[model samples]
Structures are given as C-alpha cells and as structure tokens.
Target chain A: MNNKKKIMEDLIHGIFLILGLITVGCVFLITVYLIISGVPAIRKIGIINFLFGTKWASTAQDPKYGILPFILTSIYGTAGAIILGVPVGFFTAVYLSKVAPSKMRQIVSFIVNMLAGIPSVVYGLVGMMVLVPGIRKLFNIPDGASLFAAIIVLSIMILPSIISVSMTALDAVPRDYEDASLALGANEIETYFRVSVPAARSGIAAAVVLGVGRAIGEAMAVMMVSGNAAKMPSLFQSVRFLTTAVASEMSYSAGLQRQALFSIALVLFLFIMLINATLNFFMKKGDVH
Target chain B: MKRSLYKGAMKTLMYISVGITCILAFSLIGYVLYRGIPGLSISFLTQKPSYLKGTIGILPDILNTLYVIIASLLIVLPLGVGAAVYLTEYASNKKIVGIIEYAAETLSGIPSIIYGLVGMLFFCQFLGFRTSLIAGALTLVIMNLPTIMRTTEESLKTVPNSYREGAFGLGAGKWRVIRTVVLPGCVDGVVTGCILTVGRIIGESAALLFTAGFAHSVHGFIDGLSSSGSTLTVALYVYAKEQGEFQVAFSIATILLILAFIINLAAVGVSNYYRKKRTV
Candidate 1:
C-alpha cells in the first residue's frame, strides 16, 4: 500500500512536469516550423534578392520576388503610428495616472480596456468605411485605402496598449519622489513631466516597444485599409506591409510563390523576435528601477 | 509668467489627449452599433447564407465560433492550470521555473499570423487534421496558454502557503493538498482566464483564417471539429473584403463588439467578486 501510494505520487509529479514543459515545447515547435518552411524560398531566390530587390511579382511569367517594398512599408507604417499615437497615449497616461480623480480614472480605464477588446476585424471594417473615404475626400486622392489610412487605424488600435502599460508604470513611481518634487517648489505638472516621467521612463519605453510589436505584426486590418498593393511605401500611396505580403498571397500562391510567402513570414518572425528581445530588456530594466 | 505659461500648456495638452481618447472610444462603439443594429433580424441570426435564395445569415459563423471557443477552452484549461500548478506548487528548481516563464512570455509575444501559418503547417498538413475547426482550436490553445497560465499562476500565488501547510499537517500528500487546497482557491483566476480566452478566440481572425478555411456550413460539435468553417471574425473579413457584403460584415462586427463588452464586464466582475471574498 505504501509503495503504491509513492508510485501514484511519482506519476502525478511526472504528469505535472510534462505540462510545465509543454510551453517550452510549443516555442521550440514554432521556431523550428518557421525556419524549416521559410528556408527553401530564400535558398531559391538568394537572400539578397529576396530581402533587397524592390519588385515583387510573385505570379508573373518572370517572377521578381524582392520584398524591399513590404519591408520598407512595415517600417514606415510602424514609425508613423508611433509618431501619431505615442504623444496622445503618453499624455493620456499622465492624465489618468497623475491628474484624474479615482472615479474618472476608473471610467477611463474601462474605456481603454473596451478599446483593446474590440476585434481587429471591426477596426478594419470601420477603417475601410470611414477613414478610407475620409482620406479620399480630405486629400483628393483617387483611392482612400492608402498607407495613410492604415497608419491612422494602427495608431488607434495601439493606443490602449500604450496608455494602460504607461499608466501602470507611472502609477508605480514612488510617492516619496513626487513629495520631494513638491517640496522643491515644482508645480504638479512640472513634477509629473520632469520627475515622475523620468523615473518611469523604462516602463514607458517598454510600452512603446510593445506598441511597435503590435503594429508590425498586424495583418488583416492593414490588409483591408492599405489596399494590398506591392508598392514602395509612400504616405499617400497604397502599400503592402510585411504581414499583408504573406497574408494576401498565401491562399492562391503555388510553388515558389507559396515558398516566398513562407519566407516573408520568416522575415516577420525575425522582426517580432527582435522586438520581443528589446521589450524584455526594457521590462527587466523597469523591474530594477 | 513663463513658468505659468509652460504649466498651462502642459495641462491643456493632457486634457486634450484624454478628450481624444474618450471621443475615439465613444465614436467607435456608437458607430458600429448605429450601422449594424438595423441589419440584424431573426432569420438573419437563425439561417445560413443561401445564394439560390439570395439571402444571407451568419448562423453558421456564430455556431462555428461557439464550437471553436468551447473546444479550445476545454483543451487549454487543463494544460494551462496544470502548468500553473506545477510552477507554483510542484517545481523545486528555480532554473526550470525561469525557463518555463520565459517560454510563456515568448509565446505571448508571437504574432497570431505566425500561429496561423504554423497551425496550417503542423495541424492541418502534418497532423492531417486538415483545415478544420479542431485545428483552429488547437492553434488557439497554444496562443492562449500563456494567458491562462499567467492568470492561474497569479491566483495560485494568492492561495496562501498556510493552506498547503495545514493540509500537509493532516498527513496529506503533495498531489492531494494541491487537488483540494490549491486548485479550489484559483477558481477566480480560471474564470477570468476563460473569459479572456473566449474573447480572444472570438476576436481572432488571422490565426483562424488558414487553419480553419472560410466555409459557412454548420455542423454539430464533433463533426464541426472535423470540417472546415469560418468563425464570425473570419466571416466578417470575407464578407467585407472579398464579397462586398458590407451589411453582413457590419452585423458581425456589432455582434463581436457586444460580445467583447460583455466579456470585459465579466472579467471585471469576477475579479471584484474574488477581491471582496478575500477581504470578507
């Protein structure tokens, strides 16, 4: 009876151990799968031609599989979104964390959560209907579904992440520091912007990095509003992102075309991994301060 | 005079940012509802789209979403909760714990589109699950595992070490103590995790698109898992982007919006209830 009980405990412990390892297993699985499927196309096209050549006619008679356009578009779009979104989100975070009354803060936090919860497809649908047309009318563009429309939608989509994360960081600023700032004759706004902001800078940096990850990884909404054209990115021109480059062609792509899509996904995966590393670095720094 | 001007400018900017945030939120919610609510009807909610009859319905997409959520939740709960339990209660080595936690963080950071490609490659092709709802659910299980694990681990941390001590003093084993004491205390975490996972599954489009191809046929749970279908998000994408069916897309978006609101409320309610219980 005693031996049987010991054996049962051992079995359960082993089961739990396996469960704990499953997450690691999944990470390993995804990395391996992406590399395996993503390598063949690169080998065929040559890495330089694949990554730098500007033209992308995957289905043409003489396929030119340069993805510089997608890469540039992704970089430009994410930068535009950060430029447009960070200031608003940062100011909102300051207001909520340092200035707003508790009740008002609670309400705003709920709104932020709601904004985060709204489906990406819904964002896309609304962008397609409103922002696309609005851009066309505002700028006298032939088509509203340009990189500009995508940037606007992405900026809105990333706001919740930027606000909530920065708010948490701001709230974590030591109360005694703020008290010290006040004692030194600094106004509330001055203390918050100068003292509290610097103290929470690492956390805010992490928030911006997080937003970058979200913006770059986004596919469907960008696909809908960015017009899915393989053009070098211009603010007012239709362009395809790295994500949409993979998504737009995956369905009907065959042979090298399909392989190229996988390669695009692989490139995207590398970008995400790089962002994740930076985010981790900032997050760890935030923890220290 | 310069200092006062600087302060006033900073204050004005802060308030304007808050105003912009609120305006964006209210306008989004209001517009989706305003455009979508009028398009919803009884038959529209109950029947499938029929080309011959020239009528459209999202009953299939709704049912598909339900099936995928239920399936994914059933699979993810055990794995996530068990992982959390192990990390909290059973693990003795700090290195293993760190590695597991790091892996979970990495999983959470991965894009859903990558999950789609992998799900398509592994489950749909390699495992021969094909482009089916089950494949999609499995992919979601991976996507949401980190969420459930983190929430459960957090709540497990709150399940006082004294409870375990007391159970052990009564001559109970480790597994026994965990089954009775640890698991029961993390109910709020599991509930919150489930609600969040449900919201994610509902909102998920990029991951489900390829793993579960865009089919609108309705089926029973078991059959549905084996067959290809589109969730509501995917359906909305197809209708609006591919078919020029704006009305149907808006309707689906509104439904998704309402579901998202309810899930947010449920998450808050559960956490609040647990907090009160702990306090009392």
Candidate 2:
C-alpha cells in the first residue's frame, strides 16, 4: 500500500511538471519556427536591402524587395496612434480614477470595457464605411483609404487598453500622496496632476507601451483601410503597414515572395519583443515604486 | 480668486477630456449597431453562404467559431490548470518559476499575427494539418494559455494556507489535498479565465485566417475540425474586403457585437456572484 501510494504521487507530480512546462515549450516552439522559416528570405535578399529598400514590387519583372516603406509606416502609424490616444486616455483615466462620482465612474468604466470588447474588424468596417469617405471629402483626396484613416482607427482601437491600464496605475497611487499635496496648499486638481500623476508615471508608461504594441501588431483592420500599397507613408496617401504587407501578399505569394513575407513577420516579431521588454521594464518599475 | 480660477480651469479640462472619450465610445457602439441590425435575419444565422444560390447565410461561420472555441478550450484548460497547479503547489525553485512566468508573459505579448505565421509554418506545414480548423484551434490554445494560467495562479494564491495545513494535518497527501481543497476553491478563477478566453477566440481574426482557410461550408464538429472554414470575424473580412458584400458583413458584425455584449455581461455576472458568495 505504501509503495502504491508513492507511485501514484510520483505519477501525479510528473503530470503536473509536464503541464507546467508546456508554456515554456510553446514559447520555444514559436521562437524556433519563426527563426527557421523567417531566415532564408533574409539571407537571399541580404538584410540591409530587405530592411532598408525604398520600394517593394514583389511581382514586377525585376522585383525589388525593399521594405523601408512598410517599416516606416508601422512606426509612424503607432506613433500617431500614441500621440492621439494618450492624452485623451490619460485624462479620462484621471477623471474616472479621482474626480468622477462612483455612479458616473461605474458607467464610464463600463463603456471603456465595452470599447475594449468590440472586435477590431468592427472598427475596420466602421472606418471603411464612415471615416474613409469622410476623410476623402474632408481632405479632397481622390482615395479615402490612406494612412490617416488607419491612424484614426488604430487610435480608437488602442484607447481601451490605455485607459484601463492608466486607470489602474492611477488608482493604485497611495491616497496619502495626494492628501499630503493637498495639505501643503495644492488644490485638488493640482494635487492629482502633481502628486498622483507623477507617482503613477511608470504605470502610465506601461499603458503607452501596451498601446504601441497593439497598434504596431494590428493587421486586418489596417489592411482594410490602408489600401495595401507599398509606398512611402504620407498622412493622406495610401500606404501598407508591415503587418498588412505580410497579410495582403501571403495568399498569392510564392517562392522568395512568400519567404520575404516571413521575414517581414520576423521584423514585426522583433518589434513586438522590443515593446514587450519595455512593457516589462515599466511594470517592474511600477512594482518597485 | 486666482486659486479658484486655476482649480476651475483644470476641472473643466478634465471634464471635457472625459466627455470626449465617452462620446467616442458610445458613438462607435451606437453606429455599428445601427448599421448592422438592419441587415440581420434569422435566415442569415441558419443558412450556408452560397454563390450559386446568391444567398448569404453564416451558419458555417457561426459553427466554426463554436468549434474553434470548444476545441481550443478542451485542450487549453487542462494544460493551463495543470501549469497553474505546478506553479502554485509543486514548484520550489524560484528560478524555474521566474523563467516559466516570463515565458508565459512573452507568449501573451506576442501578437496574434506572429501566431498566425508560426502556426502556418509549424502546425499546418510541418505537422501536416493543412489549413484546417484544428490548426487554428491549436494556435488559439497557445494564445489563451497565459490567460488561464494567470487567472488560475491568482485564485490559487487566494486559497488560504490554513486550508492546506488542515488537510495535511488530517494526514491527507499533497495531491489529495490539492485535488479536494485547492482545486474547488479556484473554480471561480477558472470560470473567469474561460469567459475571457472565449471572448478572445470570438474576436480573433488575423490568426485564424491563415491556419483555418476561409471555406464557408457547414459541417459537423468532427468534420469541421479536419476541413477549412471561416469564423464570423474572418467571414466579415472576406465578405467586406474580397466579395464586397457589405450587407452580409454588417449582419455578421451585428451578431458578433451581440456576442461580445453577452460575453461581457456574463463575465460581470460571474465575478459579481462569486464575490458575493465569498463575502457571505
């Protein structure tokens, strides 16, 4: 009976160990697969030309595999989204965290969660039908699907992440910090902005990093509205983002073109890894504070 | 007077900013519902989409979504729950725990598109699954593992140490203690994780597009796993982008919107109920 019980315990322990290691296994699998599949195209095209080339014509008689345009568009799109989303999100978070009555806070926070819950495709559809035409009419551009429309959609899509995260950070600020500032003759608004905001800076930074990650990695919604043209990004001009560049061509692409798409995905993965590192850094700092 | 002016001006700015944010959220939701509801019908939910019939039914897409959710959850729940158990109950080495936690975090942070690419290469190509629903479901299993593990780990932490001590004092083995005392206490977390994972799978589009090729045919669960099909979100993309079928797309969007709404409500209800029970 003792031996049998010991064997059962051993078996259960082994099962739990295997299950625990599955997450590590998955991370290893994804990294290995991406590197193995994403490298050959980079080797053939040469990293500099592939990463820095100014033009992309995968199907042209003499194809050029430049992806500078895609890279820049992704960066610019993410930056634009941050620029547009952060202030609005920051203020709303503050209002929800500190100023709003409990009832109003409950209603507003619910709306924010709903915003987060809406599928990205719905945003794309709305952008496609409403914002695209509106942008064209507003700017007198012949085509409505441009980088600007994509920026708008991305900014809206990222708001929920930013607001929720910043709100948490803001909420976690020790109440005594604000009380101290108020006791020192700082008004309520000044106390929040001066004391609470600075105390929660790391959390707010994490929120921005999260927004940047979301915007940079987004594919379908941007694809629907960005016209998928591999041109240099201009605010009012059609452009293809790094994500859309991969998605638009993967269906029909063959040989080097397909491999090149993998390389683009690798580039995107690297960008996300960078953003994830920054997010982790901020989160650690927030914990320390 | 000057101090009051400063306070008044800052307060006004905060209110304006918050008001604008609320307006944007409400307007988007209202607009999507308004546009989508007009095109929705019972037939749209039940029939198979066909070009020959020139009819737009999303039965296949709806079923595909359900199958993917069920398939992915069936696999993920065990692995995720087991992993959480190990982390909370079995692990002694801090280094191993840190590495495992970091891996989970990295996995969550990686975008779904990368999952689509890697899933295409590893599962579809190497594993010979082809572009089938199983491949997509497997990909989603990876995507959702972190969510389940995190939530489970959280709830496991909440299980009082005294409960574990009581079980051990009674001469119960560690495994028995966990099976009886720890697992039951963490049921709320597992349920929450399931709800969150379901919401994510329903909203997912980019990852599923490649792993599950967009074939719009209705099949039984088993057949659907082997074959290719589109979920509602992917179907929305194809119809809107490829087929120029905006009406069908809007109707699908409306259905998805309703699904999201219900999922959010369920999540709130579950957490509230559990919290109340715990307080009592």
Candidate 3:
C-alpha cells in the first residue's frame, strides 16, 4: 500500500510538471515556427527591398514586394493613436483616481471596462459605417476609408488600456505625496498633476506602451476601415498595414507572395517583442518604486 | 489669482476628458443596440441562412461559437489549472517560476494575427489538423493560457499555507492535500478565469479567421470540432466586410454585445463575492 501510494504521488507530480512546462513549450513552438517559416521569404526578397521597397503588387505580371508602405502606415497610425488617446486617458485617469466620488467612479469605471470588453470588429463596423463617412464629408475626400479614418478608430480602440492602466498607477501613488504638495499651498489639480503624475510616471509609461502594442497589433478594425491599398501613407490616402497585408492576402496568396506574408508576420512579431520588452522595463521600474 | 486660474483650467480639461470618454462608450453601446435589436428575431437565432428562401440567420455561427468555447475551455481549464498548481504548490525553484511567468507574459503580448499565422502553419499544416474548429480552439487555447494561469496562480497564492500544513498534519500525501485543500480553495479564481477566457474567445476574430476557415454550417458538437466553420466574430466580419450584409452583421453584433455584457457582469459578481467572503 505504501509503495502504491508513493508511485501514485510520483505520477501526479510528473503530470503537473508536464503541465507547468506547457507554457514554455508553447512559447518555444511559436518562436521556432515563426522563425522557420518567416526566414525563407526574407532570404529570397532581399531584406532591403522587402523592408524598404515602396510599391506592392503581388498579382501583377511583374510583382513588386516592397513593404515600406505597410511599415510606415503602421508606425504613423500607432503614433497618431497615442497622440490623441494619451491626453484624454491621462486626465481621465487622474480624475477617476483622485477627484471623482466613489459612486461616480464606479459607474465610469464600469463604462470603461465595458468599452474594453467591446469586440474590436464592432469598433471596425462602427468606424466603417460612421467615422469613415464622417471623415469623407468633413474633409471632402473622394474616398472615405483613408489612413486618417484608421487613426481615429485605433485611437478609440486603445483608450481602455490607457485609462485602466493609468488609473491603477495613479491610484497606487502614495496619498502623502499629494498631501505634501497640497500642504505647500498647491491646488488639488496642481497636486494631482505635479505630485501624483510624476510619482506614477513608470506605470503611466507602461500604460502608453500597452496602448501602443494594442494599436499596432489591431488588425481587423484597421483592415475594415483602412481602404486596403498598398500606398505610401498620407493622412487622407488609403494605406495597408503590416497586419492587413498578411490578413488580406493570406486567403488567396500563393508561392512567394505567401512566403512574404509570413515575413510580414515575423516583422510584426519582432515589433511586439520590442514593445513587450519596453513594457517589462517600465513595469519592473514601477515595482521597484 | 494666477493659481486659481491654473486650477480652473486644469479642472475644466479633466472634466472634458471624462466627458469625452463617457460619450464614446455610451454612443458605441447605444448605436450597436439601436441598429441591432430591431433585426434580432427567433428565426435569426434558430434557422440557418437560406439564399433559396431569401433569408439570413446565424444559427450556425452561434453553434460554432458555442462549440469553440466548450472545446477550448474543456482543454484549457485542466492544463491551465494544472500549470498554476505546479507553479504555486509544487515548483521549488524561483528561477523556474520566473521563466514560466515570463513565458506566460510573452504569450499574452503576442498579437492575434501572428497567432493566426503561426497557428495556420503549426496546427493546420504541421499537425495536420487542417483549417477546422479544433485547430481554432487549439490556437485559442494558447492565447488564453496565460489568463487562466495568472488568475489561478493568484488564487492559489491566497490559499493560506496553514491549510496545507493542516492537511499534511492529518497524514495526507502531497496529491491528497492538494486535491482536498488547494483545488477546492481556488474555485473562485477558476470560475473568474473561465469567464474572462470566454469573453476573449468570443471577441477573437483574426486568430480564428485562418485556423478556422469561414464556412457557416451548423453541426453537432463532435462534428463541428472536426470541420471548418466560422465563429460569431468571424461571421460578423464576413457578413460586414466580405458580403456587405449590414443587417446580419448588426444582429450578430447585438448578440455578441449581450454576451459580453453578461460575461463582464458575472466576472464582477464573482470577484465581489470572493472579496466579501475573504473579508468575512
């Protein structure tokens, strides 16, 4: 009986150990798979032409595979989203964390969480139906689905991450920091801006990084609203994103076109890894403080 | 006078920001429901689309969504819970724990599109699962693993060390102690994690778009898992973007919205109950 019990315990231990390593195994598989599949196209296309070539016509008699347009559109779109989203999110976080009454805070926070819970495709649908047409009429552009529309949609999509994260960071600020600032005769607003914001800077930075990640990774929303044209990004011009480049063509792409799509996904993976590193740095810095 | 002016300007800016945020959320919810509810019907819920009859329904998509959820959850909950158990109760080395945690974080940070690409390559091509609901569920299993692991790990941490000691004091084996004490204690976390994972799986589109090919047909759960089909989100995308069927898309969106609201409420309810129980 003792031996049987001991063996059973060992079997359970082994099963749990395998389960624990499953996450590591998954990460390893993704990395290995991406690298294996993503490298062949990069090798064939020449890295410079692949990364910096200005035109993309995969189906033409003589196809050109330059993805600079997709790269630039992604960067500019994410930047526009950050520029528009951060201030609103930052001030709202400050208000929610410091100034709002509890009942008001609860209601507002619930709304924000629901906003987070809303599916991205719905955002895309609304953007397509509303924002695209609004921008077309407002700017009197011939086409509604332009890079500008994508930027606006992405900015809204990223708001929840910025607000919730910044709220947590601001809420964690030592109350004494604000009390000290206020005791120096600074106003409540001044105390929050000067004392609380600076105290929670690392967390806020992490929030910004998280928002950037979300905006950059967002595919379906941008794909739906951004007219799927591979052009150099201008505010009023239709553009393709790295994500959309992969998604739009994967269904019908063949041979080198398909391989190049994998390369685009690899490039996207690298960008996300870079963002994750920066986020980790900020998160660790916040923990230390 | 200068400081008073500064304070007034700052407060005004903050209020405007809050107002904009609220307006954005309310308008989104209000607009989706307004456009969606009028189109929702019993036929929409129960019948499959029929081009021959000039009618459209999302019964297949709904069933597909349910299949994917059930399939993914049945697989993920065990693996996630087991991993969390090992991390919290069994893992002795801090280095191993750090590595496992970092892997989970990295997995969470990966974008869904890349998961789609990799899942297509790995599961569909390599494993020969092909483009099917099982493949999609497996992809989502990876995507949701980090969430479940984190939540379960957190609750396991809350299970007091003394309880484990008491189990051991009663002459229980390690597995016996965990079965009796630790697993039962973290039921709240598992429930919360399950809810959150369901929300994510429901919201997921890009990842499923490729791994699960966008064919809308109702099948039994076992059959559905083996065949290619569109989940609700993917169907929404197909109807809205590819087919240009706004009414169908809106109706699906409304159903998804209702599901998301319920999931969020349940999450909050579970957490609140856990908090109240803890304090007591």
Q: Which stretches of candidate 3 lie over 4 Å from their true place?
A: A1-4
Instruction: Show model 2 residue runs off by greater than 4 Å.
Output: none
Better of 1 and 2 by DockQ: 1
Least accurate 10 contiguous residues by lDDT in model 3 chain B: B1-10
Q: Count the backbone clashes (under 3 Å) in each candidate.
A: 0, 0, 0
**Candidate 2 chain A lDDT trough over 10 residues, lowest sum:** A106-115
Which ten-residue region of model 1 chain A has the weakest summed lDDT?
A228-237
DockQ of each: 0.85, 0.80, 0.81
Residue-level lDDT of model 3, residues B45-99, one tens digit each, is 9999898998998899999999999999999999999999999999999999988
Write the residue-wise lDDT of candidate 3 on A1-289 in tens digits.
Answer: 9999999999999999999999999999999998888889899999999999999999999989999999999999999999999999998999999999999998998888888889999999989998899989999999899999999999998998999999999999999888889899888888998889999999999999999999999999999999989989999988999999999999999999999999999899999999999999999999988
Question: What digit string (tens of lDDT, one per residue) describes model 1 on residues A16-117?
Answer: 999999999999999999999999999999999999999999878899999999999999999999999999999999999999999999899999999999
Provide candidate 2's TM-score on chain A. Answer: 0.98
TM-score of chain B of 2: 0.97
Q: Which ten residues in a row have the lowest lDDT in candidate 2 chain B?
A: B9-18
For residue B30, model 3's alpha carbon misses the true position, in angstroms, by 1.3
lDDT (tens digit, per residue) of candidate 2 on A140-228: 99999999999999999999999999999999999989888989988889898889999999999999999999999999899899988
**lDDT (tens digit, per residue) of candidate 1 on B1-280:** 8989989999999999999999999999999999899999999999999999999999999999999999999999999999999999989999999999989989998989999999999999999999999999999999999999999999999988889999999999988999999999999899999999998999999999999999999899999999999999999999999999999899889999999999999888888899999999
